[model samples]
Structures are given as C-alpha cells and as structure tokens.
Target: MFQGRRRPWAAVSLFATATCLLAACSNAPPPPVVSEPPPDAPSTTTSAPPEQPMPVEVVVGVDELEGGFNPHALADMSPTSSALADLMLPSVFRPAEDGSLQLDTTLMESAEVVPGTDDFTVRYDIQRQASWSDGAPIAAEDFVYLWEQLRSQPGVAEPAGYRLIEDVASRRGGKTVEVTFERPYPGWRTLFDNLLPAHLLRDAPRGWSTVLDDGYPASGGPFAIRQVDLDRGEIVLERNDRFWGEPARSDRLVLRAVDNARQVEALRSGDSHMALFGADAATMRSLEELGDTVDLINMPRPVTMELLLRPDSRGMSDPGVRGAVTAALDRNRLVEAGTGGRPAGQLPAHAQVLSPSEEAYRPTEPPGAIPPAPDPQRVERLLTEAGYERSAGAWLRDGRPLNLVIAAPFEHESYIAIAETAAEQLRAQGIQATVVTPTGDQLFGDMLAADPRSTGTGGAGSVDMAVAPRPAGGDPASMLASAYGCPGVSPGGETPFPYNAAGFCDRLLQPTIEAGLSGEVPFDKVSDEVESVLWRDAVAVPLYQQAQVLAVRKEVEGVRPGNGFAGPFSTAAQWLGTHADDDGY
Candidate 1:
C-alpha cells in the first residue's frame, strides 16, 4: 500500500467550530434582554451601518493580446499568453527573485526527488485544499496530461524534459503524484510550469491548439478570466474567490491592447495604471517626460535575434560559402541597425542555444581564432577555397553569380532593418545579395523549413537567409534540442517536426545533443561541443537578445519587472491598485 500525506483533521475540526460560531453570531439573535428600559425613556438612537469599501481595479496597457492562450504550444508563446498563464495557471515551482526555482507551498505540500535505483522518480504531495476555480482537483492527472501532450505534440515550447518522463502515477484519490523518468533530468523543474486542466482539456475537439483560445474553463491561480474580448482589444481578469491561497490584492485586472504610442498616452493620461510594450526612442522619451509620476524599467524578453543561413539554399549549400558569409558581417553593426534608437537593452548574443541574459550563458568562441569583427580577407579566402572566383567585384561559380535572397517578416521592423543592413554589407563585400519582405508564416513555415533532400537546391520561393528570432526557455537542454535537433516524426508517424529553423544537422553532433537532453551526459559537458560544431558549420550568426520595457505609475504597488522568461506578469497576483486602502481592501 502507498502511504501519502493525510489531511489535517484537527485543523478541519477547528475550522468547522469557527464557522459554526460565525454562523450562530450572524443568524441567531442574542437571548431576549431580561431588563426592559423605562417606558418613558427616549428610544436609543440607532447607529448607521458602516460604509462599504469600493473595489479596486487596475488597467494595464500592452502592445497586443492576439495569440492563442496556450502557454505550452509554440504558436501561443507570446507575451500575452505568458502573462495570462502567470495570472491563471498553477505551477509546483515558480521562479524566485534570483531566477531560481522555488516550490510553491500554496499549491503543493511537498515536491522532491525520490530515491530510485533503476530510474529517476519524483514525488509530489499536492495541498489537500488545492483545486481549480471550477472545483476540479489539481492533481496527477494534470501532470500526466501536460507530459503526454508535450512529448507527442507537434509544436510545443520545449518537450525534451517531458519526453524523458516514462510514467506518471496517481495516488490518494489523485492528490499525490509519482513521476518516473527514463533518465536523471537536471531540468525537471522546468516541466509542468503552466499545467493545464486535464478534466477540461483531455479530449478537447481541437486538441492543444484550441486550449484557452478565448477564455479559461477554470483557473488555478489568484485571478480567473472574467472576459476575453478580442474585438475590444481587452482581457478582464477578476479575483478567483475559490483560490485556496492568499487572494489577489486587486478586485480586477484589465489588460488593454494598444499600439506603442497609445500605450504611452494611456499611461500619461492616467487611463491605465501601467504599461509594458516594445517602446521606440520616441515612446521612451515620452515616458521619461512623466517625471516622478512613473518609473520606467527595461524588461528582458525570452528571444534572441539571429541571422539564419539555410544550409539547403543555393548560395549556402557549400560549407565554405556559409563560413564566408558568417565572416563578412559584423554582429555589433547588426545589433545597432536592428535596435534603431530603441532602448531595447539588447546584448550581442554569444551562444547559439542560450540567450545572454540566461544564468547558464557562456560565450562561445569563434572557430580558428576568427576575430569578432568582420574580416574581408577571411571572407575572400573562404570564398576562393569554395571554387568561387571574384569577377567584376562579385563572386561567381561556373558562370553563375553568387546571388542570395535574404528574407524578413514584413511586420517586424527590427528584422527588416537588420536584413537590409546585412544585404548592404554583403553587397559591399562583392557578394550579390537582396532583401525580400515576406509574412512570418511564409518565411518560417514554407521558406526556411524546406527539406534539402526533397527541395534539391532550393528552387523558387526559397530564401537563402533570414533574420528572425529564436525563443529561449528555462531549460538549456530543451533549448538546444529545439533549436538544432534533427527533424522528428509526429505521433502518427506521418507529419514531421517543423521547428528546426537552421536546416543544418550534423550526424556526429546529434548523439551528443540527445545525450544532453536525456541526461545521459551533463548539459555543460555537451553544450560547448555542440556550439563548436554549429560555429564550424556556420549554421547561424547570433546578433542580440530581444527586450521590452515596462512603465508603471507610482500609485500602483507591488508591480515589479519579472524574469526574462515570464515578464512583468509573473507578479500579477501581488499588484495592488491605486485606490487600495492600507489594509489592501
């Protein structure tokens, strides 16, 4: 028989007694007073009832809230989704101020690694009172559901940790959970961050994509979805009365979507209490004009900007050509051009898998003592070695000019600027290059994801290079695998994984990446080797990490900048409105 933590009967009894006393006090009138006042005495003046406090509501302005709300799915990995998840989901572990994982005791009684000889095991003791707003228990089934979907789904945020899970066992009427892993995963804490409700979503019609599309069926955190009005560009979150832990400080939270200028204007005009957006120089200056009424802070976003060279493209097929292209452009220049006077607080990305803001980030040196600065000599030498001769200031191979098409999403201004700058630099270095604007879906899904074996030299509608963003997460192993691993077959074995944007996979390095992800080897042991291989192949040139800005009025209390992954919404539960009394009514 499996022994699990028992509910506190003593505490329950005491709570019952207190509830009975409160009910009696309210429902039963005091025993009839034996002494009657003198008939002639004036009747005692009746005291007036106390005034009720007004509810507090905080309105926040943001860039947009137009993505699917599923936090685990790739298509929903936007700022809006992250913010919503932080406000409505339950997690066993949450990020601390130092970016370390800490057990959320309100949600779990205990969560720790269990002793196992053959396989790794983790035991979770959920709080007895922990339940969703809809009265569903937050238990082992939720963990199992998340693990199953993430490991099998096509476009998940990071499935490496979940893939290592062998089985999830339930006990104590589904309150206790035992998870057995195939290997010793160091990044286990990263799993099940935004656990979905298994009872509601286990058999949804559209599966993972439709999860939280309009509103949550139930909420496990301090706030619940009151309304999601896409047409009105607003999402209203009300305090979850069923929350077992501390209640939200504010009565309601309003997330209002608006443009950058409008976000600043709302904050200035006091229409919104706070605003978080990707601000340009003009917007930053506008916020600065608010003086002491507001405080502006830079918040790190979980994305890195990179110049991806598709190995299957015509100009990039040869390793030498790819190396030459990588050597010809300067990362600093690219960052400058991409930021374009915006106070993005971007740092030149040095590692392929981890962003500069990450705790485990270590700069990877370029191959063969290659300097960080652009080297024209190295570019010329590499191009010549690849059998390309300089003719009339342009490299040509077999009477064909070495022309390349660089693509960027038409909606992303920063990426477009970076692409144009790269084109100018390549043209200056005697390489024929042109910039093309394409929709993000077309650029990423169709152009960059083309398989070399079938495409056969990348015919029409193929881009030789792209300026895009690569998302980073808490788990380094998962980040490495998602960014560079070989294409995986779907659960049905018909569809292929389409997230590997590099289109460059080395057979020798695949084993090392797998070992790191599965915990057969330490991530530190394999990350350096994999990064070296990627640099040698010139898979991509990392430019900088993306960032956002948050401006909060002085009246709003308890709002702080969150970690790079979760943004400001991580502390949403603690946000108090301007009208909140000293008692936080």
Candidate 2:
C-alpha cells in the first residue's frame, strides 16, 4: 500500500513541472525580423570625402631666358635677369608708384641718413626675423660683399656709388649696418638694391658672372627659383616658405620664353596668364586682335637706347668718322622705328648719362650746333676730313672701303630693329654697313671691353659700333662715371677691366667726373660740361628710352601697371592665378 502511494506522488510532481515551463514560455520576448533592401537604394555604409582645392599657378610669357643673372653686372642686364632679381632678391628700398624711394619694411627695420655726421653715413637696421630662403640671416655681410664687389669689380652697375663708401662697419651681430662714405651721397637710397647672399657667393667657384647665372643660391623675396631650364626657355619660381614678409598669393610663377606669336596664342589658349616683352608693330597688332581678353599697357624701362661708336675700332678711332656716323642718322626717325610709333616712347634722350625718364634729366646741346635732321653734306664733309675719299659711291681710305660692322644683341628685338634701320640709313648714304647680331656677352664683355691701347686696330670679329641700352641709374654722377670714366686703377697700380662702354677716355675730364662723384664739385655744375665733351667726341647717339609691352589676361588679379622704373615684376608677389579658390574647395 506504501509503494502505490509513492507512485501517485511522482506522477503529480511531473504534472507540476510541465505547468511551470508553459508559464515561462508565454512570458519570454520574441526575436527581431530584418527586411530586404531595394535594388536602387543608396549606400549607407560611408559618405564621400570633401573635394580638395587646386594649387594656384601663373604662367608668364616672355621673349628669352638669356641668363648670367647677376643684376649688378652690365653683361647680364636682360629682362630675364631683371625680372628674376625683382622676384627673388631683397632690397632695403624700392621705388614707389610715384617714383620715390620707399623703405621696404619687410627687409629693414629702419634705413636712414645718420644725423650730425660730417661724413655721409647711412645706418641700416635689418629686421632680425629677415632670413634668406636657405635659413641664413640677411645682414651686414651682404652689404659689405656688395659694396666690395661693386667698388672693385669691372663691368658692374653703378660702381661709383660703392666707390664712395670708405668703410662698411657692422655692429649688433651684423644686424646693424653703418656705411661711412668718403663724402656726402645724396643718392644713398639707391645703394644696396638686390642684395645678394654673401655666404653663398663670397667664394663661389665660378665668381660673380656665374654665381646666379642658372639659378639663385638663396632667395630673400617672396619667390624662390624652383627650376631654371634654359634649354627649354623656362624659369619656374615657387613660394618661399621661409619668407618673413607677406607670403606669395600664387603657388608658382612660371616664365616661359616664347616668340610674340606664340605668346599671343598662349594667352588666348589659356596657357599663359601674362606676357611682358619688347613688342613690335606686328606683335602689338596681334595682341590687339585678342580684343577684351587681355589688358595691355606700356612699361617704360629705366634704359636708354643709344648707338655707341667704339672709339677703338678701325675707322671709329677717328673722331671725325664717329661724328660722320652720327650726322648720317636721324634720331627722330630711329626713335619712331625703334618704338613702333608708340606714343609712350620717351622724348629722344637728350643727355648721355641720364635717360629722359629720370627726374634729374637735363638736355644739353651738342657743340658747334648741328641740325637734328639727317645731313648728307655734313656726313660727306666729316668723312672727307677723316681722310676718306668717295670711290664708286663708297667712302674709301688708302684703297680700303669704309665697311662698318654694327652689332646689337641678338636677344633684343627693339635693338635689332634699331640696328637694322640704322644700317639701311647708312647704306642709303653710300656707306658700306652691315649688321651683326652677336650674343650680349660677346659684344659687351669680349669686344667692347677690350682696351683700345692694347687691342690696337680692327681685327676679325671686331665690332665697329653697337646699338645697346645705356643703363640709367639713380645717381647721375655715378651714371656719368660708369658711362665715360677712365679705367679704375687699384692702389697697387693694377687696372681692372674697364667698364667704359664708349672705349673713349679723357684723362683731363676724369678728375672733374670724380669731383662730381666725390661731392667736391656739384653734379649740376659739371653735368653740362661733361655732356658737352661726350657730344663733341661723338661717343653715343641717344635714340629713345627702351620700353616693353605688358599684356595681362583678364582672369589675373592684383596685377596693375607698375612704376616705369620697376616693371610688373615688382608686384609679382601679389599676383593671383585664375584657379585660386576662396573656399579651399
């Protein structure tokens, strides 16, 4: 009976367990159900990244990239050289729009004429933060190097300014420059322009001529040379990250040397953003055909186009022959031809040492008052006086024909035009004249720089006369000395190469020129007399101020006409490319 009771209890326990399990199953939560996505549904896994903004670059078209880009050297004074200097070099003073000297606060803290000084002194305090692209401080050593080089180096620009400096005293770890001049220099503002890097160029292997020929050793301006592919006629400048002043608006400035036609085409096709070149009538017309696509302006360069008679050349050695050559050509006609009838061509430069654009320019008449018009009779008389006789419509002396070889730099378009026109005029007057276009170096450095006393007479590859630019400087006295001074002699009695372009030196007048430079005699007092001497000797015939046409595309911004003294390159740092994005898209 007890075993039967236990079996009944087990069955009841099993029934209770089944009831509890059913109650737990009824209270539990249900599993989630997922639906299928549509075939055309957009992605939900990830969103697209933001678009990146493009870098801004401006491409400029020019005539040629002929280098040897030492701005102070006469042989390297080309548009390319000047542009590169303006873009990459530093200056304590820069020309304002009104042609006044303005201190570049970016490079200097202060540059002033020291007060209470009997000796002319200029105190320059460089910005301590001003450092070259290579991380070297821009300091007094640069000034000392430039002063020493300009004072002693031959064929340098405006050496007289540096020659007057007695000493360059540096203080405050070279950040302060104290320049003591032998005498008062009113044109002190003109010194120390385009200051080069002393640490790189002081003992350069190739010297001054080749120091910055291909590319800059370091940059002190907003732009630094990135690449200089002379073979491809291109120079690329990129922003200098180390620049202490305002950064360049554009990332790169590419200068491409191309022909006029190609330049116009490039501008039209959006390949070039601007063009600065010596334009002719045909080139101007082609640029005009672009209509509203470009804004064109005439930029007067601080250079005077002049015909130089090499006094040391065979026939030119005779003053009478030089005068005859001058009498045969018409200055007005040459000006018209050289400028292609541009109204902005400065009035025929009347002074030899100063261009018409200069503030101190004064017109001095030639001695013995000759008419400005072409005088065939005067030409004939002068030639006859020089012991030449007319034989078969040609001037002949000692049974030899008077054949003159006129030279102009092959890279200069306006100079070539002037040379060709002058040659034609000479040929029309029964004078045998031919034009030779050699490189500027061959003409200026090799041929014209030859000392007449040593070279003797004409030889093969000799240039009788040349059509070249008379570089106009800030100091009139310095300009006078550079163009006409005698070869400078060192204290050791050694003469460096001559910088005189005329190859004519008068010992008597040199003292007067020096006096004017040394502030012993006033520049105004000696200018007329000095000019008279140059004119009487027939050293050079001034044509017109050299100028270039600047055509900027409509898309470019922050590019306006610059002062005649400084070309568009002066404000290159402010230029903006068309692709410049405000939103950094």
Candidate 3:
C-alpha cells in the first residue's frame, strides 16, 4: 500500500550553533555536583521514594531518513512521519486497528462524510486551544492552505494520494471547515492533513518549502524542529512548551546518522544512544554482546511483494506465456529472498501473508530460515511446452532468442535479487533476459514516459519486469487496489514499478476494486474477484510477502511494536522497560 521507507544518512547536528550558557561567568564550566540529601536525611533504598517518572527517549531504526520534513511537501511518506503525524499534525479521521474509520479529535472536534458522495463535505469542530509553535491561533484556513499546497506540489505523484478532495471552504466564524468532493471516494477522510503554521510559513520568503526543508520554526506537534547541524550529523527537537497535549518530556532529542557497519563502532565507542535503520545482522549480534545498550523496534506489514506483468507487454500479452511464467516461477524461494537473509512465504492456497501470528502459516523450515531448494527444474518444464525451448544451450524460438529486460530499483535489495532470479528463470526457459538498474527517480520517469497501452514493455520503453513491495492492509481491498487498480496499471502498457509495471487493465477488476476502496462493498469479495481476474488473465504473478524484524534493547520501556499503518503507536509507548528487557540474555 506504501513504498517501504528507506533513508540515506546526512550529517545533521543541532548543537553546533546552539546557545548554551557557559560555566560560572565565562569559560570554566561548573563542576559536576551530585544532588545527595544532606547527611541528616534518612536513607530510602529499602523502601524507595516515589521518584517522578522520567520522560523516555525513543531512538528507533529508520531505513532511510525523511526526504523532506514538511507535512505539506513531503513526497515519500515514512512510518516515522506516519508516527510523527500524530505529534506534528492530525488527521480528521484515521484508519483503525479493526480496519474501520475513526475520528481523531485532536485537531478537528468532529468529522463525518456526506453519505453517498466521495466528497466528504466534512464539518469540523474547532479546538480553540490549538495553536502553532509560533503562538498563532490554529485556524480552519490553515488546513485550507495545506490542501492547496499538497495539491500543487508540481508533480504527478505528489497528488496521487490526495485526489479525493474537490474543494475546501472555511467560513468567517472561524469555527468550522467544509470539504466537498467531486464524487464518492472512501479515502476522503485521509485528506484532512493536520495544518502547518500558516503564520510562520505565510510570510517566509522562500515559500513554506524552504522554511521546513531547511529549518522548521513553527509547528503544532509536541515539538518544533529547533536546529540542524550538518557537521555533527544531527537534528534536535526541543519540546514545545505550548503544545496542547502532554508535552514531550525530553528537553532535546537528537537523530544521528551512522551506517550499519559503523553502528557497532558507534555503540562500542559510546558515540550513539540508539542505532537506526539499515543495521546489519552482525551489528545487531555485536550489540547483543554489550547488552541493554541498544533498542530495536519491529514494524509489521501484511506483505511487501508484488507481481510484474505487463498487460500491454508485447509477446507476454499472451496469456499462455504469463501463465507458463507463473507456473515456472518458484515463489517460495522468491518470498524467502525478499526478506533480508530470511526465508518467508505466502502460500497461494492460504489467506494469511507469511506470519507466526496467523495459525494457518505452517513453516517447512526452522523459524527464520530460507530454504536451499528454489526448484529451477520445475520452472524449466513449463517454458518448454510454451514454444520457448532451449536451443544450443540458450533459450530461443523461431530463429530468434527468448529475451527480456527487467527494471529494478536499488533501494530494496529484494528487487535486485528478483531481477537476477528473473534472468535465471528466463534463461532456464531458453530465454535471454537482461536486468536494468535505474536510480529511483529515473525508474519512475522512464515508466511515466512509456506508452502504457502498447504490448511488450509497452511505452517509450522502460521495463520488462519490475519487482515492487505491496504493503497489505487489514482488508484485501488494500492489497488488491495496489496491485490491480487502473491508476496503478497503465492502460497504455508496461511502465515501471509502484505503477502496475505489468500494465494490466481488467475493466471488471477496476470498478469492483473501486467499490471496495469507496467502502461500497466488503474487500474480501474484492480480493476474491480481483485474484480471479488475475487468475484468468494471468495478469501478474503473486510473489511471497515480507516481514520486517526489529531488535529492541532491554532498557527501552513502554516499547510495543505493532503495525503502524494499522494504528499510530499500536504498540508504542506502552511496553515499559529499561535496557534490561533484551530477553535473549
């Protein structure tokens, strides 16, 4: 449902230009003094005094840091932001754990969509106490400005998630806000992104983007972005003394950047408080040796693998090749490889997507083990019958060679392996396949340029096969829409990933899935219906899903790791412990 969040570290130090008070008068810092009670004071070690609870500082791993920090301009949505969205901005109504829509009363007092119309035409109850970091009263127009800004981010992908809003009107009384839509859309409730400070941003010279991109001076969250120092590699967030809810307790929280290799060095040398995303297995194992020093958080997703069939793909447009290809692929092996150094799978006959939580997933290997037999012999047989046969030890057909070009993004390691596997499988079938590595930006650009309707890698030319992660939601509609929706797949043909690289266009599947997206019908039927179309059309193959693993330090408290997409802090801030909870020891 979302692109997996990956962050590249950049040097950001908030303390470089800080205004810290000098020791004594000038220079000569004050001496460290213990705050021990006077000698006459009674000792309370046996029956400890009720000490006030200290604020917990949570430092979790992020695969990639945020591309942009602004709520309005951020293009790549990260779970950190999704989690921070609660602290930073607020949604009118959010998706709940049970897969139902529920209201967030923090910003708007109340919200309800107009029945029968995709346009929510929602009515908002104002919270007068709500104020931005700059001390300006929160207003409905703040939301209005944010709406226009997000809609005008100057790129096609910018507004893809926000297409439901038709218009917004906040009246003069300053107590209400209304959103009207062009048609019936169920995702409308996701539109009311919590407003940024119109006061601080409105007058900035470089527009809002520059202010937040370079530095944030105003916000409604628990804290405002205080400073960024590139040299020390850190960003500091200071508690907002004016926050409406319980203020964040930490006076200053820092986000540092260190690679997985150096993370162990950072931990051993006492250079870091917590290791972030991109940590390798070796680093984690090393941290385990130190014990109670590092924390890990695991975020779960239903699945993160997708099929790459070109509906408009040439030659492959034939159902036989697609089906034969499906029958040829060893999905179990592919699934196991998707997760880093781990075996994972999603059986075709089952409803569960690779999980220990669901009783239906029976493991063939020991827990957390990838199997060795990927079964290539079975793949060879299927292609032989499809007229693509091995000739002179190479796949060839009708005096021509069976060839394919796969497009893969480097961000996800799985795509890299899948591309290689795809090449191998095609080779076994006597087909020659080439894998192309395109930068993230270039991959999408190439896909957008291709004529989506043309068969065989259709378009201006971009991809043959693309491996993408499809984050599953509680409902099948979430999974189905991402893989089979019309907007997802190009009508013109194969483009590139995130977009239906397969360019599958099933008129029936699209509308039915729409019904589910708009909450018209149950997604279970949508899933059944779409899979049937995929089954008949053989539009795309379903590879195995992915499971994310996070390692938490023992000392970290109230750290419950659940599905963030399901609910903000689903398990966050509840699991209380100190560096002593690293159960392994």
Candidate 4:
C-alpha cells in the first residue's frame, strides 16, 4: 500500500568541512607531530596499548569481468561489475532480503517526497561525513553531475525516468539536493544509486564513458580498490579507512574471475573461498556429498522464460485462439522438459509480470484459471466457439489450415526442448503446429524478413511464436512497458531492439505503465492493472523464473544472495572469514 505524504524530517549533522587555518598556510605546510605522552608525565601509565587487529581476506569467484565499472554505461556493466559496485559505490537506498527498499544512512541522511509540490519532487540530504576515496567531500554536486552526464549518452540504455528529471538543485552549502521531475515518477528511489566523484569526472579528457575501466575509480563506498590484475583475473579491495559508517568487518576482499565450469573445482581446490555456481540437479547432489565443508545457496533470478505470441502472424491474431493455446499447455511440463533434469529449482510462474518473490506478486489469471491438467476438450471447445472447425484431421478457419510455426532459438538447449514439447502438445489438440530452430537473429530480429522467398535462414514472415527471456531488474515496470505496451513493433527502429515479439499495443494501458514508472501509483495497483491487461490479452505465456545458484564454503559468514539485483556480495561488508566464536587460526 502507498502511504500518504509525510511531514518534513530533519537529520543530525555528522561532519563539517573545515577550512585550512590561515589563508596563507598552504605555502609551507606544518610538520607531522606524534601525540605521545610527555616524557616527564608518562610514569603513571601501565602497560602499552594492545596491538591493532589484522585485516581478513575474502576470495570471491565469478565467471569473468565485463571490462569496466561504470554503472551508467552498458558495455562496462556486468555481473562482476555490479557485484563490486554494490560495495564500492554509494546508494541512497538498498533492497532488503525481502525485496523492500531501506535507506542507507552511510550515504544519505534523509529522503522524502515533498508534500504539496507538483511534478513529483524529492528532496535528499547527504551525510556530511561521507567522502570519496581521494578525500573529496561527497556533496550534492556529485548527484547533479551524474544526471548531466547520462541525459543524452548513447551507451546509457535505461534513461527513461532520468530524462524526466527537470533539474537537481543544491542547497544549504552543498548539503542537500532537490530533484524536480517533469512528471511524477514513483521509481525515483532507483535513481542515483551510484554517484561518481564530480571532481574526478568533471574535467575528463574523453568523457565519463571512456574514463571508467575494470581497474579502479574514486569511489565512496565501504571498500576501495587495492589491485586489479586482469592478466591474473583477479581484483582486490581493501577497507576504506575514510568510510564514516560502521567499519567493514573484513579488511580485504578479493574477487577472482573463473570459468563457470571450473567454479566448483576452484572451491574444492581451495583456490577461492566462495564461488558462484550454476548447480544443476546432479551438481547439487554431488555437492551435497561434501558434508559440512561447503554450503549451496540458491536465489531466484529476475528473468522469466516465456512464449511470445505474435498477433501479426496467422492463427495467433485472434485473442480467443491465443487463450485456448495457453490453456492447452502445461507450464510445469515445459519447465521439466526444457531444463533437462537440471535441478535449478525452477517453479511454475503464475503472476504475469511480477516475480513470485516480489512484494507485488499476485495471480493475474481469472478465478479457476488453468486447471491441474491441460484440458484438450476445453481447448477444442474454445477454438470451435472462435469459428474454427476440424477438417481433414486439422483445424481449419476461412478455408485455410490452422497451421502455425513456432520459431525457437537453439542458442540454448532449454529453448528447443520447450518448443518441441509445445509443438507435440498442440498437434495432439488438433492444431497443425511444428517447431523450426533458427539462428538468434532470425528468431528474435527480422523474423518478418523482407524476402519471403528465401529459405534456410530467414523466418520468411512465417513465425508465430518464440521462446525467449524477459528481463526485470531494480524496477520491473520500465522493462515491462518496453516489452508489452508500445507503439507496436518499430520496423525501422534501432539495432538489437528491432521488434516487440508480441506486438501488444494498448493505448489505455500506457498511462498506467507511465504512472508505475513514475511512482505516482502504488506498485501493487500498478502491477494489478498492467498484469490484468497482459493476462486478458494472452500476450505471452510465462513459464518460470530463471535459475541462479551459488556455492559457498562453510568458512564464509554473513553473505546472502537475493533473487533480484545485487547478487551475493550485497552484504559483503558484513562477511567474516570464520565463525564469531572461533579462536583457531
């Protein structure tokens, strides 16, 4: 539920930026002096103070680094970069274990929606004590600088909500920032999660995009970059002594890059302490044999595999036909066949657009929808009611065979298996259906190729259904809008995003999608409206959430992976090398 407007809140002052004593003091700096007790007055002291604790080193494994660490650019963004960014960059709010947003007091003091203000204004105050690794104060200008750099860049993909930001004004001597949006944006908290140092980026030679690489940056998080050896495929981070909040428990954290196949071996050989693994059923069973030496952790991914129905193609144009087809298929059977005996713990998806673990997850299908067993009789009845009749062992409508070709990409084994199972089931239900495995481009882009007579490559304007993955990240509404609600498929659009498979275009649902992205409406209400439209139209049949598994050594402590964004390292600062009570070295 969305709460109403609240009163303005105040924050306690943490630190003040002090000026150098005397304007001319910088010409010749003062000498360093130790604060030891005077020689004449030190006789009363007992024994010397205890020695400081040594830093703990944590070795983490990943598939590989994606070349850079800039959160704004796509080329530099990867799972490895994101894992490090969650620890190195400042965020106003963070996702809790249950998928709720909580304020990170280290970076931000207080953030609230300003009441009686139009166009959805949010006021944020930064913690005065926060400073970058280079000792520059973290101020409002950093937030403003990030917005200015990302507004028109080609490398920045997710810029819809940011484009709506009219201005970000600094106030109270750089302690606060007021962001004004052109329209209400509900997902504003998702913005400015990673702010770069304005002093470092303000005068870059080539620009911000080219300045960031996989190596290091002037970051302002709990940990700072210590070493980056791409040749050795390892990145090391040490605790930032300048950090103002509770100090990081582990003094040193190392991320080692390894191939997915070698992850388990690396863990077993003691090359890495904690490694990310895609443990299938057999792998998990084998890992269970390791006893108390290791522990396996599984988290649900935000990606969902679904069948995209193209209404522009034949047989699938009618909503009734699509509904009947959806009822005739079993999602669980598809998952079982597609996964090929791998125990990623895939669960059948019911909520249309939201993940099962998300707060807004709810069934969008009507009451008593989708019986336990797929009813072939019900499917036939629905098709008959929609002006289809059985003729010569195939369903026919308007003097043509109700034949459809499902275009499945062989990029992965699961896609082909799902398509084969679907084709077999549809044929049993009296529909003439077949599966055609094509290249990635023909399956997703140019399915309706210009040349209808070409063979062996192009879909030739004959594909009716496609099996693909839909992605959902920090904000699902933005991704859902681009996938479902649109100006139909753009024939001459940009590359990579050539077409919208479903070609679902509903003018009525557009406003709700915008409101959802704007945060003008509660997420539950927004999800309800958007999912209702998707289910009623049978736009796409969602099967299940993608599988994400990780293997951790029992010696690791306090690291947990959430299903969505910010993988296992989201809590890296709390990690320890051994149990709290352990005394053995």
Top candidate when judged by lDDT against the true structure: 2
Order of models, best lDDT first:
2, 1, 4, 3
Full ranking by TM-score: 2, 1, 3, 4
In angstroms, give how far residue 575 of model 3 lies from its true place: 11
RMSD of each: 10.0, 16.3, 11.0, 13.1
* Candidate 3's TM-score: 0.66
TM-score of each: 0.79, 0.83, 0.66, 0.64
The superposed Cα distance between candidate 3 and the true structure at residue 516, in angstroms, equals: 2.6
lDDT of 2 at 584: 23
Flag regions of model 1 displaced more than 4 Å: 1-54, 207-215, 312-315, 328-330, 367-381, 388-413, 416-452, 456-464, 487-499, 518-522, 563-565, 579-585
Q: Model 4: C-alpha RMSD to truth? A: 13.1
User: Taking the tens digit of each residue's C-alpha lDDT, what string does model 2 give over 1-585?
Assistant: 001123578789999999888877895665467777898888577768987666788889997898689888777887888898899899989888788889999999999989998888999999999999999999999999999888876557677777778889998999999999878777788899999999999988986655777777899999998877899998878889999999999988889999878999999998899999877778889899999999998777777888888777776888898888888887777788777765336457877888776777877765543348778999999899989999889999999999988888786777788888889888877788989887766666656666655644432226778887778857788788777888776444576645566677888998898888877898888787788877888888877787788999988888876664777898988999866433221
Task: In model 4, state the lDDT of residue 439.
Answer: 54
State which candidate, 2 or 4, has the greater lDDT. Answer: 2
Superior by lDDT: candidate 1 or candidate 4: 1
| lDDT tens digits by residue: candidate 1, 210-249 | 5567767889999988877888898878889999999999
Comparing 2 with 4 on TM-score, the higher-scoring candidate is 2
Distance (Å) between predicted and true CA of 255, model 4? 3.1
Q: Is candidate 2 or candidate 3 better by TM-score?
A: 2
* lDDT of candidates 1 onward, in order: 0.79, 0.81, 0.52, 0.69
